[model samples]
Target: MTGTRTQVVVVGGGQAGLAAGYHLRRLGVDFVILDAQSTPGGAWQHGWDTLHLFSPAPYSSLPGRPMPHQPGQVYPDAAHVVAYLSDYEKRYELPVQRPVLVQGIHRDGPLLQVRTDSGTWSAHAVISATGTWWRPFVPAVPGRRLFEGRHLHTVTYRAPADFAGQRVIVVGGGNSGAQIAADLTGHADVTWATARPPRFLADDIDGRALFDTATARRRALDNGQADTAGVAALGDIVAVPPVRAARDAGLLNAVPMFTRLTAPGPQWPDGSITRTDAVIWCTGFRPALAHLAPLHLRDRHGRIATTGTRALDEPRLHLLGYGDWTGPASATLIGVGRPAREAAREIKAILGPGHRPQG
Candidate 1:
C-alpha cells in the first residue's frame, strides 16, 4: 500500500460521485474516484432488491445517459439501477477505484491528503459526494440498555421476510419507516413510531404533490423560518390536502407519538402501552464526514457548510444530493445537474480540459 497522487479526488462512487467523475472525464481533468463499496450505485445496491425509485425514469437519469427504462415509468429495481450505473461507467470509461474506505482527509501543505484503507492519495482538490445516508441515526432512549430484542437499523434491512409472525415496532416516520410499515402489515403485527409523520403522497395519479411540498419547505427555509424543528413540525408537506383527508379516512392509524420505551415495550403519549418483539430504527442519518478532521469544515449544526452549492472549505470540494442546499430542488436528480455541471466547470478551469491529471 503505497501512496498515489492526483489533481482531484472524488469520494463516494454513488450517483453523485459518478456524475462528478463523468463530467471530470469529459473535461479531461486528472482525477480519481474512491468508493467504499465493492461496486457502484451507493446505497441503492444495499437497499431491498425489490425497491424502485419513486421518481420516473425521465427525472432519474444522469447527465450523459438516458435511464434504461421507459421515460415516465417507475425506475426498475435496485439491481437494474446498479446495472445502469455499471453500464454508465463502462460506457464512458470513468476511472473509479472501489473497495477503498476513506479513513481521513487532511491538509498536506497546499495539497490535500486523502487516506484510504489501501493507501494515501494526494490531490489539490477533493469533491466529497458521499451522500447523507451512510450513518444510521438511532436516538438514545432511557432504559434502552435493559430491553433487548433483535434490534437493527434500517440501513441493514434487506427484506421483511424475517419479521413474519413477529410483533415489530418501527421507529421514525420517514419514507423508510412508512414503506416498512405498509410492507409488514400482511405478515407481522407492526407498529410505527415517529415523532412526526412524513407527509405521504399518493401515486402519479395525484401528480407532483411531493414537489409542491418541497416547494413550501423551500419557501419556509428561504424566509429563515424553517430549521430542523420547523421541518419536523410541518409534517408531510409533500402530500396534498386530499391525500391527508383520504389517509385520515382509515388507510392507516396515525397514532400519537411514543413518549418512552420501557424494557417491556414502548409507552405512547396516550398513556397506553404495546409490546414488541423487535425494533427497526429508521431515524435519519448524519454526515459521514467523521474522517475529515484535518479540514475542520462544519456549520454550527455540525454539518459541512456549503456556499451556493459548493463547500466553503475549498473551491474544489462540492456536496450533492442534499435535501436542502440552495432550495427544495437541491436533492433531486434534475436539481443536482446544474451544481454538478458547475463543479465540473470550475474543476476543469483549474485542471484544464479532458479531466487529464497534471503530472
Candidate 2:
C-alpha cells in the first residue's frame, strides 16, 4: 500500500548502523540504511589523525570481520578503520542510501514516515543507530568571543600539525582530550584542564591488565556512588593518559578544571590563570533530537526514551548505539552491535512478510 516502502529503515551508517544492516540481511529482512555522510564509518573518518580506539583490537572489531591486528594491539589509525567500514559496506551489499540527511521521523497513520531531502518513505519499523556523539558539547564560556585566535572544538580537530607552535588549551580530562593533548604536545604548547586530576589508566600499565580502575568505578556506581562520588570520581569518562604520556613528560600540563574563561585565558580555583592562543573544547556531546519533536518521547534527563537496547516505545521506532550511560561496552565500537542486531530481529519478528498492506 505504498509508492516506496521498506520492512525496516535504519538511520545512521556507522559501526552500529552497519552492524544492524548486516544482521538484518542475515535474517532475510527487507530494509534500507540511511547515512548523512557521503560514505560510512560515521564520525570516525573525521576524527583526529592520531586516534586509535581506547579498546584493544579484539574488543573493537565488528561482528564478522577481523580487525587485522593481534587481540590487544593498538589499532592502526583512523584511515585504516574507515577503509574497513567501506569494505564492510561492499561485502554485505547493505542498501545504504547515503548523502540523504534524515530531517525527522513522524507517524503517518500506522506507518512510520521518514523525511529526507530526497523524499519521504514509509517503513514498518525504524532503527536509529546514531552514535552517542550526536552533538558536540561546547559550553558558553564567557569572553570566548573576545579571544582573537582561531578557536575550534574537538569535532573540528583533524591533526596535530594544524596546531603546531600554537599555544593550545584542551578543556577536558576524557580520552579524547588526553589523546589530543598527547598529539599536540610534540609540536605545540598544550595545557589540559579538568575539574580534578584524574587517576590515569593506560592501554597496559606495568605489564598487567589495566582493568581495576574501570571495574572499581563501575562497582561504585552500581552500589549507589553515581551521585555521591560525583562526575569526577565515577570515571564514567575515559581518563587514560595517551601512550606517549605527554602530561607525565612535561610536554603537557594538567590543570584543574576551573570556572569562567577570561579574555586572557582559563581561571583556576586558586586564583591562577593559564594563557592560551587557542582553546579546543573537549567537553563532551549531547544527542540532537530536536527533529524528534513530534514523537513526544523523552527520558528523565531529556533524552529520547529507549530500552530493550535501543528498541523505542513506538511500534515502529527503535534506537541503537544508546549505551552511552550503560557499561564499558556501551559506547565502544564493538558495543553497539548487540543492540543493532536485536533491533533487526525485533523488526523482522514484529512485521513478518504478510503484514505489508496490499497496494
Candidate 3:
C-alpha cells in the first residue's frame, strides 16, 4: 500500500485509534492505522501490569464489539485489554500498519502526507488519536532538583515489590495516584499527596455512574442547559477492589502537597520534613502532539484546538481521544467511538458520496 492511494490515515493505534478505524471501515473508506508499537495493544500494553479499566465491561468496550471478559467479572486487567484490541483488529479486518512510527504530517496540495519511519501515507484526511501516555507531566517544586531520592513518573512504575520497606510519596489526585498508593501499602510506607484533597466516590458507585453522568452533562450542554452535576472531571475515583482494600486498611487518606523537596524528602510549610525513599509521580499527562508540530495545530497550552472532532482550522485533519475538546470523555474506550464515527462521517461527506477504497 502506498500513500498516493489511501484515503484516510489514522495515527496511534491505541483504543482511540482503533475505535476510529472501526467506524471508517464500516464506511468502506480506504484507511490505515499507523501504530508505533509492534503489537496491537495501545498504551494499555505499556501500562502497569495490574492496571484495569475503571468501568465495567459493558461501558469499557469499543463500538459494535463487547470486550470478552469472564461472565461475572466487571473490570478486565491490562493483558486482557491488549488481547481484546488485537482480536478486534483481526475481527474487523481493520487496516493497521504496526511498528510504524509516524514522524509528522504536512499538507501537500490535495492530500496530506503522513511521514513515518517506514513510508509516507498520503491521504485526503488524517485522524490523529495518539494519546497522552507518552507525555507525563510532573509539577516542579522549588527544591525538587536538590532531592537525591529516586524519582519516577507513573509511566516507569510497574510493581510495588521494588519499593519494599521504603517510605514512598505517591503524588497526584487522580485514579493513578490512588491505585499506585494502594499497591504500595503492603510493600512500602506510602503517603498520598494531592494538589487538593482527594475525593473518593461512594464504595458502590463505579465507572458506570461516571459515564452516565458524563452523558447527561453532554446532553445538557448540547441542549444549551446549564447543568452542573458531578465533579468536572468524571466522578472521582471508582471504588475498585484494590482501592477499597486500601481504604479499609486506612491508607486511602490524602495529605496536602509538600512545599518543597529536601535532600531525603518533601518539607511541609510547618518546617517538618518526612523522610521519603522514593517518589512516584502519578501526575496526569498532557496531550501528546509532538508529531503534529509541523502542522502548527496547538495553542500555547500545547493543546490542539478542535470543534468536536474536526480541527478548527484544517477541515481534513481530525484529532480524536485527546480530551473533552474532541468529545465528551473522548479519551476513554467507550467515549472515543462517538468522535471516531463522527470524524469518519465528516471525512466521507467532504470527499463526496462515492469515494470507496478497495478493501
Candidate 4:
C-alpha cells in the first residue's frame, strides 16, 4: 500500500473536518483531511433540494469564513449551504483529500494507521469527524418489511414531487420530520407521526439561539452549577418559515406514532389504519464511526466515552462533531469551531515542539 505520514490525519472532511483543518493550520500542524465525497460541500451536497437552515447565513458559518448571505433569504436553503461549504474549503486552502474512502484506523506502534481506499496514512493523532448523515437511523417498526409501498429515509428524500398525489406517512418529531411533512403538505395526503406531540420552538428561536443555550448549559455543568435546560426548554422543532406556514394552514399536525406497519399502511394504537402509499422516515441518524471499529472504542451503548473530544480509552483518537457528547452543538456548522480548536490544540500539545509541517 502507498504510505504517507502526517502529524495528524483528519477523517471525514465535512464541516467538522474543515473546521479542524482550519484550526490545525492556524497552529502550524501538519495534517490532511480525508473526505469520502467526490467533491466539496460534504453532506450538505446530499441534503434534500429544499432543505434550509434554521439560522441565517452569518450564524451558519464555519471557523474562518462566514457563509455569504443570500439576498431575500432569511433562512438559506440547502443549495446555499453547499455553495458556502465549497467556497469555505477553497477560501481557507484547507488541505483536504477528496474521494478518499477511509476503511479503518488501526494502531501502528506509536502511531495510528488510517487505512483508506486510496492508500494508508500514518499519523500521531487521528480526528474522526465523520458525521451522522451516512448513518440514518430508522426505528424497527413491526411489519415494516411487509409494507408494499415505497419506503425511504430522510437521507433519500429529495422533493414532494416524487410523492405527489400519494398518501404518505412521515415518521419522527424532529426538525427533519417537521420540514419534510410541511414540504409534502400540498402535494401529498401526508400524515406526520411522532411518539408524542411535536414541540415547536418560539418563532424567534433559531440555530444561533440554540447554540448559545447549549453553550450556557455546558458552562454551567462544567462549573458544577445547576444544569440549565438548554435548547430542550425551548422545543424540538424550529418553526422555520415553511413549517410555520404549514402549521398556520393546519397542515402540519402530527399524529401519534403507529404501533405497526400493515401491508398497505400503518396500524395505530386504537387499531385505526391509515392506508398509505409511502412512508418517509425522518427518525434521525447515529454517528458514523465504523472506521473506528478497529480501535474497539465504542462501549456497549455504542458510544465512545470522551472527556471533551478526546477518546477516554485512546487519547490519540479524538472524535469531533458527532453531537453533544463531543461538544455542545458541535454537530452544527457554527458550533463545530470551538471543539475543533480545542482538539487541534490538544493534538499540537501532544505532538510537542519537535513535530513541524512537512513541505
Best by TM-score: 4
lDDT of 3: 0.85
Q: After TM-score superposition, what is the CA distance of residue 171 in candidate 3 from its true location, in Å?
A: 0.5
Residues 1-359, model 1: lDDT tens digits: 45788888888888877778878777767788898999777878888644655555655677889776844345456677788888887888888898999988888777788999999988878887777778778899765666667778877776778888988887876666666666566678877777764566444422133444556766666688845443334444233332334345554445556777777777777777677788888777876777676677876788777765567776656666665663355455545555677777776787654444444
* Candidate 2 global lDDT: 0.70
Error of 4 at 275 (Å): 1.6
Pick out the ten consecutive residues of candidate 2 with the lowest summed lDDT.
Answer: 203-212
User: Where does model 2 exceed 4 Å of error?
Assistant: 1-3, 70-73, 202-244, 310-312, 325-328, 353-359
Across residues 1-359, which tens digit of lDDT does each residue of candidate 3 receive?
34545889999899999999999888878888999999999999888867888877777889989987745557888888899899988999988888999999998888788999887778899999999999999887788898889999999999999899999999998899999998888889999999898778878777667766777788888899987763465445777999989988887899999999989899986889998898999999988888888888777877767878888878889999987778878888888888889999999888887875432
lDDT per residue for candidate 4 within 238-299, as digits (tens), equals 99999999999988999899999999899999998888899999999999999999999888
Worst 10 residues of 1 by lDDT: 237-246
Flag the better candidate by lDDT, 3 or 4.
4
Candidate 4: stretches off by over 4 Å: 357-359
Clashes, model 1: 13
**Candidate 4, after superposition: displacement of residue 31 in Å?**
0.6
Model 4 residue 319 distance off true place after TM-score fit, in angstroms: 0.6
Q: How many backbone clashes does candidate 3 have?
A: 1
Please tell me which predicted candidate would have the highest lDDT against the true structure. 4
